[model samples]
Target: MKKKNDHGVFAAVRMAAASHRLLTVGTVLCVAASVAVSLLPPLLLARVIDRLTAGLPLSFLAVLLYFGSLALEGVLTSAQESLLVLFGQRMTHALRSEMSRKLSRLPAGTLAEQNPGEVAARFSGDVDTVEALFTSGIISMAADACRIVSIMGVIAVKNTGLALILLLVLPLFAVFTRYVQKRMLAAQLDNRRAVAAVSGQVPETLHNIRTIRALGLEDYMERRYDRCIGDSYAAMERTNFYDAVYSPVVLLLNAVVVGIVMLLSASGNAQLLTLFGMSVGTSVAVINYISRIFAPIESLGMEIQTIQSAMAGVRRIDAFLDQPERTIPPARREAARGDVEFAHVTFGYGERHVLKDFSMTVKQGEQVTLVGRTGAGKSTVFKLLLGLYQPEAGTVTIGGVKVGDITDRERRTCIGCVEQHFSRVPGTVLEQITLGDPQITGEMAKDAAALAGIDAAIRALPEGYDTVCTEGIFSQGEWQLLSIARAAAADPAVLLLDEITANLDAETRPACWRLCAVPPRAARCSLSPIASMRILAAERSRSGAGNNI
Candidate 1:
């Protein structure tokens, strides 16, 4: 499980080990007490049988001792349950906190490689499995082990021969559990994959909800979801079958072992009144012990299942975190001002090159425009400038500092980007602009929103600045304006505007064009656009086909 420092499974194990101490001590005590009390019933029954057969008058002291043991057992069982709950809650709290911390430390693109549904399931489904690890794996097994040993001591110390036969069967139990796990592992992984496939589909339906509504694709999405669900069911059924087969076989084996031992005791002329040095009551106690041991062995199967699920989650999280982000030369620097230059920079995600040795230079304070075909890597230029993507060959620099060299904090603070598909955030319209920037007070937000021709539209909301608008209700034009408002709030040194004017109304185009074209602070950038008369006249012009936009 150990890979690099970044892929440390020891970190996760240490997480489990160090979470809480009181819960562990409490659970151990709880298990010990419960196990001790449970063994009492068999002894009490043996006492009543022995006493009655002897024709001795029933004594009040005997009745009192039996009833008192029963009452103690009842009380201890309740305490055990309470402590188990505490153990589960504490373990979950630690797990969730660690998971959240790990998530925060990971860089962007971590979730890009994973399905959305699978990510969501980590908190819900993955944590549930972890809970089982603490409950069944820890507490249940501990109590079962205590019962097995204590009862074995009773039987072996009293009658060595009968106890020997029972003790021999434990290896068979271990072998059987191992075999069941081997059979179930592959089916478990298949179930997890089917779950992730469903999660990946949810965002597609949400993002393209309008297209689905217009073309009546709701039924199509439902069918797709149904198919994923069916696959998941098939995988679960396989896992269930493994369990169903395992349980019956184990039970049959257990019955055979105990039946042969009982037959030998009855026919071999061995004394039933005592086992080794212990009384008949203790021999019966050993029989009770065997029954308790089988339950943990059975329960261990489920714990193994939960463990397999948790291990799979750990592997996925490890894979996602271990993947190296795009790297740059070791000596990187801070962005001073956006004196941008792209020198024959070539880049690609994988296989397909998006930017083919792209070259462009914008002098300090110069506002240039990139106009190109729909898929002509125009936006790719801005992604490079913002330090989101690195070039494969050559360099992209800002104010003499290589874009690759810029520290993440400085890079984000220096550049502002407004994507074409910006989503309207929940809360008031002001939130869509300010995004909780302490310096971007209410008045500055309105000024920026007004400049983008969205002030009136924002004012029409019931709470105006405070009205909550969640999900996908904003028109494309409204989203464009909101993007502009957000860009201005950052007060960035370099601005990136991607098709912000495409969805605007005809009359609003000119104002929107000027708002983007005007320089912010000493910020100088190459303005990329799909189409705009202002950008075309100011940034690009050709006698033949003109700019591609």
Candidate 2:
């Protein structure tokens, strides 16, 4: 599978944007309307302040107008928030659906690199940042623009010279914002990476905790976790520092701009600058305008940071979705009848050849086993048959059909295999036999369990057929028999058993092999359960008896 490029991230964002189009437009309009309504109160307050020295009738009217504007702003702001929440929900739903569908189509190996825990975090933690783009980003910038425009326009109407003086600081603010933008972008990306690293590490640590304690490496594992968290802290600090430094700086500089505007307005030498002196109302309104401009600049920084992380997360998720999966064609297939053949087949993992011109054939239904010295590709042949790897040269076939022609999904359905390290899953006795195949009913499950010679042990448990055989209680031989039982439940035409007795104690070997002889039919018969077990033990107990004929 290939790692997605920047183009892929853009594509994913575009897809999300498209899916959330109506919501996106609605949120934008709500923010804009909210901003316009919120701007009105401060302008009305300035008017009331400027006109307050007049008598009670005028003052009372001003008070009523100012309070009314406040009420309208409140109503509009609430609507804005409601729309943002609705849109956020819609976007989240679309993003989650795409991610889930991608997981289904992606190959097993690609998903293996990104464990379930990390993938799960994207569904939860990563999508969380998208809210900033719609809510914080839209609302903050819109209100700021509206307030700044309203304040500036009113000031311009009263005195254009004072407005021009305030406008001079805009370029300086832009330069400063651009300076913080680079550090902010890098820090935000780093923070998201750190978050994903922590996400991946936590699950792995728990999964492997047993190994950590077994080798007296608990301290070592703890130190590793500590290091990850420490790195995450540093990344967060770097991210927060940019946000912390920029907002205060923007505020302070805007205050300086206000002071400059104030001095110009108050001094008689600048009488031409404004028709009105620096009245309390004028000072408050000018200060309010400065406050509004600060928001646009400073909020832009926060929005940029949030968007960078969301974009980074989108990149990873897009990479996962876009990556190739095993790369077999849709038309690929092979005949699956257990007539195995290998013809000058050569294969390797990287540069090291594992199979060297391997060639052989077995007739249909023939029980053939490969025995060789260690590292002689004994299991490789079995792996090759099941479509785990493709040949480097020549071909492998079943029923004269080429192995590479078979898709992995199809190949899997046609083969039943028990691996060397077959661990028993945590499940009831019946589940262990059926391997969660609901099609294999209680009767069939018992039949398969009996064939694997696990029925007696299962029946003896605290709950017959329902007993959960898990580690720390059940022995290795019990798990091996359970593993065999799982394979038998499938009713496979050809069963592949590899190293089934690798972990069993010597005393349990004969009984384990004897149990294999009790085929599925034994379970449905009138013979006693132990009777079949006894027959298996007796046959293997005698000399010159082995599993293969």
Candidate 3:
């Protein structure tokens, strides 16, 4: 199937903003009102100064108006910032939710290939950067841009020559801003990659600690980890360098512009006077406007830095969203039966073909054993039956229904698989058995445990079924039995045991074999070489005991 094109982060931002129209509109209004209110204070202060210089008494109303504008600007600015934070939060929530939904649609192979720690960084760190993009980057930059432009418009009226000078210098400042931001963005990207590596390394090291100790590779592992951290530190240093240089250069230009404006205003030449001419009140107001213009300009540098950093995160998130999704088959509501068939099935992982033109059939009520060495397609058969991957050729079916076409919920009830190891979740023993499935009742779980020969072991716990599961609560063999109980909880039609006894000791093997001998209520077919052998041995022992009796 063809993949859907990604619309990128801005599309998500727009959708989030659209959902909260009131917050979006409120933030914009606050920003505009703040910008408009900000201009009033400088004008009022200029008027008050001119009145004092002209030996005129200042009216109480005029003084009140000047202070009132200042207070109003402060209030509007505060409100705008608050609104921005709220808006950013909404965007973050929507973005994370979207990513989570995307995860379910991704191909199983795609998910298997991803590093858990790096994927987590995309969910947490990268998504947080997106929030910062809205609150402190894009929205903040827009407001600062408007403030600069508005202040320039006032200065243009007060002094045309000064406005012209600013216009010429602003573009150069913008070019420099873009240059520095690009460098910072490159550094940030490098830093994020290094951080992800460091995050992944921790889990990898913990998982392989035994092998590392056996091989005496502790020093080597430490050096490798140190190198990742060092890379991150170096990238940060580059970003800091650009950040430190940006503000000082902007301030220097601001001082130079102010100096030139002051000098020209005081010049004796008629042409310079005509262009830069200003009365005492106008001169004070123009200076204030110039200062205001540069303030936002300086702030723009910081905003741009934030934006550049966030852009790196945005690109990564977009890449994740763009990965091809698995093709979902049309939903089928009919219950799947137990007869299994594999016809002309060709499959491979990358370049190595595990099964080519293979065919098999296990009729209802039949138990079949498939014997194969490692890499001889033993586990591959289970994966194909479970529909984790699509076959290169032909079909695998359960009761004439293609396995790949089965929905996740139906597949669970269709086939019960007991893997070599058990996956523990954060919950009580009963929850572990049910795995949070609303369909499975407590009685169903208890029956599954009994079928797996672990019901007595669980009841012996402190709180029986409700006891919170923890490490050491159950031995390794018991954990495997719980896994079997979990699988059988749904009363599946077929049971696929993939080396369920591979990790069990001799003492646990007999119990597992005894449990397998007890036919499940719904299961009509059983497939596994190890399981078949144990079942036959158990049956032979029962027959021998009967004869002795």
Candidate 4:
């Protein structure tokens, strides 16, 4: 069942936060403690200035208080960083795990629907962006807010009139900042898509580099790559242009605030002067608080960009996680025997129907061979019998059990398939043959290998069954032999081969045919083509084996 696509960035964060509640709480507390401790030094400095203005000697207690607060703040800052890092790492790990699980659950066509490089970028780049949000962006923004609030409290206590003036100036800066933030969010999201596009293009070109070189399409590849690079550059340019304008605007606002403070300090109206009641020491404290307030504002600008970037990544991830997943339900009934049937099945690929009212049956312990011309729905029959694609009408059943109703465990245990091309995974020979199935031991693999007549060849390798597989080491014939061996390792009762020898040359065809005839006791081998049937019949006659087709 497909997940809903409505999941958003906020939902992703809430999910992460729910899972790591303790860590989230710990990080927030550390940030609060750190900000509170950091605010102490400025207050202490103001106290020292007031004492100096009173023409009194500085107390040892006052100096100790300032230095002690500095030391404590440093420790709290370290603790906060540690907590944030721990939280970020945990969240990233969970997200990566979730994506991996999602990939496994996704249907076969997801890779074709989405760019492989873009999917990979989601794993690394997008995940890192989200991690940075938790680690630095969110925590820093929170700490800055605490600092600003603490400073505002100081300003209010020092002089209400000045505090009121600062408040009036804040809204103008906020309005300008809100405008910039909206632009930045849109620009950053575009930049992220551009980066993903570039990432997708690079791997596509590299993976097919051989074909490009062979076809003499080097210039075309270069042009395509250049276009992707240009897109990324244009996106970054827009984001940078907005960022460039922000700094100057903030500096101008800061200059205006300084001018207002200076004018207030210089004024001599009796009521205003009485309202000020501010000594040189108080003026210094107020000016310091003003800088603190604007410092957070500056940080707020950058942090908003970081947050927007992360939100973009989150949205991508959410979309991925929300896509339809292929799920295997629990088996309703066990297979009593290796009997395959497709009754009046209708199937199609999009608008093109491959099969119409197709009916076929292969009884238990029988070798059923099907032969037809290309595009005659031959492969589609195998796909339906294997439950790879759901039929548009009618039903497919194996051993009295509906194919779709069978669990993956029962299906894997009952049937095996060798495609025209098998995916080669990196592993030792035995591991690759067993595909890491714990139930299939090395001895089982060897038995299957021997039955398939590939044991001698595998044993001749450098490490026998433990030899590592790499390109060029195994011949095409040997690879085909390994594919057969891997399929046989499951000891399945029903084996499906879909034009497996379609890609093989005459030199390797005989050996492949011989391997196909080796396992037939309590097992069924379904082969296609008249030549394959002839070869299997010839081998069966020579070995006194069971039915060939």
Give the candidate number with the greatest TM-score.
Answer: 3
How well is each residue in 98-198 modelled by candidate 4, as lDDT tens digits? 78887887766455567887898889888998998888788788788778778778788887777777789878878888888788788777777777888
The candidate 1 region of ten consecutive residues with least summed lDDT is: 540-549
lDDT of each: 0.66, 0.65, 0.83, 0.75
Model 4: how far is 205 from its true place, Å? 3.2
Task: Write down the worst ten-residue block by lDDT for model 3.
Answer: 540-549
* Predicted model with the maximum lDDT: 3
Model 4: residues >4 Å from true position, as ranges? Answer: 1-22, 274-277, 369-377, 510-549
List the lowest-lDDT window of 10 residues for candidate 4: 517-526
lDDT of 4 at 131: 91
Each model's total of backbone clashes: 8, 2, 0, 0
Candidate 1: the clashing residue pairs are 158-275, 158-276, 158-277, 158-278, 159-275, 159-276, 332-405, 333-405
TM-scores of the candidates in the order shown: 0.83, 0.78, 0.91, 0.88
Tens-place lDDT per residue, model 2, 100-209, is: 76667665445655667668777777677755555565455555656667767776775566677667776677677777777766766676666777787788878788
Clashing pairs in 2: 333-405, 346-392
What's the C-alpha lDDT at position 166 in model 4? 73
At residue 545, candidate 3 shows an lDDT of 15
